[model samples]
Target: MCELLGMSANVPTDICFSFTGLMQRGGRTGPHRDGWGIAFYEGKGVREFRDPDPSCDSEIARLVQNYPIKSRIVISHIRQANAGRVCLENTHPFMRELWGRYWTFAHNGQLPGIRSKTLEHYVPVGTTDSEHAFCWLLDQIRERFPKPPKRQTTLWRFIHQCCEQLRELGVYNMLLSDSRSLICYCSTKLYWVTRRAPFTTAKLKDADVTIDFRQETSLQDIVSVIATEPLTHDEEWQRIKTGELQVFKRGQPC
Candidate 1:
């Protein structure tokens, strides 16, 4: 299986710290080394970075670690390549324009028989099952609402149903975002941790890295991080139950 990492914050924030821990695992500390990608949502615009090379040694990955690129929503992935060949197009955190906003998606598990399902409005440019599944999901969403829903609850329900239906297909753990919100679904493994007022130190488990949140943040900052595994050894990360979907908008959502 691959790995996922995402962030939703009340205020503009950078994911460099957490991303550093994940990069080391792309080929050094763990096995997910096939490819990697990340997307940052800055208002209505999106900044995406992808490379088929292992993130452990990618120069681009090194730059991202040093860059304090800030955004309200973000999604990232490190792939193990169970269902796709290693290529630039096969990388996760795929992007597509929908309802006038760029929606980004990243998947963490394999799906069998996904190739048999042909899609109409949305089609995959990459051979990866993850991209196919993302296109299929967008098609379902478009069918549910010709345009973006006017009500928040209606849209939430629609997104949940689409995820539920996809869950029936195979392992479908995913992270989706459109700058305003981050929708996460867990079919097998996922975990999350939130940092808020009275922030404390978090020590990375895969590297000798630690960040004292208090030193770099204000009381108004609230950042919620979701990942395939806990990034820190001391922080209590909440594990998402299988078949669960949660939306994080402005750092909080049920």
Candidate 2:
């Protein structure tokens, strides 16, 4: 199994606070320590960092923790390596180009026999079933709609349907995003919380730290965080039901 983290914000925001909690789970607070990766979407481009080492000990991970790379949408994962070898290419938060836009994907569940599904437009660079499923998903989307759909919901619904089909294979909790939208699907566990005006302090469940978001954010800021588990114990996190799909854009659900 693995852990997933995502963010969608109305304004460009850094994920240092949330990421600190998640990185602890990579080896200290949790058991997923095989590898980790993160993708930050800046406008149409993505700034990505990955390492085939425990995030708790990786120097690269520390750099990311210290650097405030702001983004409107982000996807990150810490892997335990159930299906693939512990290598750089086998890391989660895989990326690919589709419809002339870069899409990022991260999974927290196993999808056995996912490779048996044929892919047309996309191919996996890694051997993990997660990556194979991502390619297959993109393949299916490309087949159904050669170009981006006119109505955004049309594509979102199709993605949810595809996720349902994949869920038949095994647990399929996932986080996916283009630069504009963050798509989350829950199979067993997923939770989300949005912070807006009159923000309050939030303390990490994994670390001895607290952040008063009010001091760091403006009244107009709206930020949503999605994770396999709640990062902070203080905030009232909303759990996503099994077999349900949620889509977030500009920090709000759509």
Candidate 3:
């Protein structure tokens, strides 16, 4: 199975610190290294990078780990390749245009017996089942609301119903966003931890380094980090129960 990582911040926040730990799982400290990709939402522009190479050794991954690319909504994944060829087109964190905005999606679990019957507007460029599922999900959303639903609860409910439909097909742990907030649906393994006032140090389980966010952040900072597995050894991460959906904005789950 692949691994997932996501960050939701009330303000534009850098993912460098948490990304360094996730990069270690992409063929270094963990086993998911077939391919990798990440997305950083910067207003109307979405800066995304994908690599077919193992992130543990890829120069691009190294650069991502070194640079502080900030975003309000971020979705990232480290692939383990259950379907599709090992190529850039098959990487996770795929993007599609929807409701005049670029919607991003990434999946962590394998969906069995997934095949494309037909697509109306969007099509899958890659052969991965994950991409196929993403396309179908986007299509469903567009079908339900040709225009964006203004109410948060309405949009959230729409996604909740759709997630249940997908889960019936197979495993559906995922992170989805549209530059505002993140919609996290956990079918299996997923955990979340938020850092805020009275912050403490966190040591990466894979890396030997630790970071004290208090030294680098302000009093109002509240950033939520979500992953397939807990990244740090110290923080008490809240694990999402199966079939539950979480909405994150400005780094806290609501």
Indicate which candidate wins on lDDT: 2
Per-residue lDDT of candidate 2, residues 186-210 (tens digit): 9999999999998999999999989
Per candidate, the number of residue pairs that clash is: 0, 0, 4
* Candidate 1 regions with alpha-carbon error over 4 angstroms: none
Candidate 1 to truth, TM: 0.97
Structural similarity to truth (TM-score) of each candidate: 0.97, 0.99, 0.97
TM-score of 2: 0.99
Residue-wise lDDT of candidate 3 within 4-45, one digit each (tens)?
999998778899888899989999898888999999999867
Residue lDDT tens for model 1, 4-86: 99999888899989999999889999998898999999899998898999999899999888999998898999988888789
Candidate 2 residue spans exceeding 4 A from truth: none
RMSD of every candidate to native, in Å, equals 1.0, 0.6, 1.1
Candidate 3 pairs with clashing backbones:
8-251, 9-250, 10-250, 224-251
TM-score pick, better of 1 and 2: 2
lDDT (C-alpha) at residue 39 in model 2: 98
The TM-score ranking, best first, is 2, 1, 3
